[model samples]
Target: MKLKFGFEEFILVFSISMFFFGYMRIKFTFMVIKVTDYYLYSYGNKGLLYCSLGLIALFTYFIIKYISKNVNTTR
Candidate 1:
């Protein structure tokens, strides 16, 4: 099947992919840090890790999307 899509479609897909990969990588790194910290603490608390990673991911995604939008806006 051959479906034609404009350049905007490609940019949108690329942006979404970047955001997803960024979030997953950040979340995975955060989990690893939590596990190591837990080992050292023995009685660890991981309450804010999720929130912290989520915020980071969100901010990063927004920044990336904004840049992509602006850089390609002229197109």
Candidate 2:
């Protein structure tokens, strides 16, 4: 089989990377919460969590929309 690279491939790679990055960010955020549960009370960790979650949601939405808009495969 031959290799082919194009816009669809680029979007696929980008979306996958974004998903992994978002997952890591969420995991790391929870780790931080666990590690700093005491001090996090004054440091607005909740705000950080909410912001990160919003960003992740937006990224997911954009990726889904892009994939749906660009998808041309019939099989």
* Number of clashing pairs per prediction, in order: 0, 0
Q: Which candidate has the top score in lDDT? A: 2
The RMSD (Cα, Å) of candidate 2 is: 6.6
lDDT of 2 at 12: 57
Residues 1-75, model 2: lDDT tens digits:
789987656655665665566555555656675655656554455545555655666677678776887785533
RMSD of each: 8.5, 6.6
lDDT of 2: 0.61
TM-score, per-candidate, Cα-based: 0.40, 0.46
Best by TM-score: 2
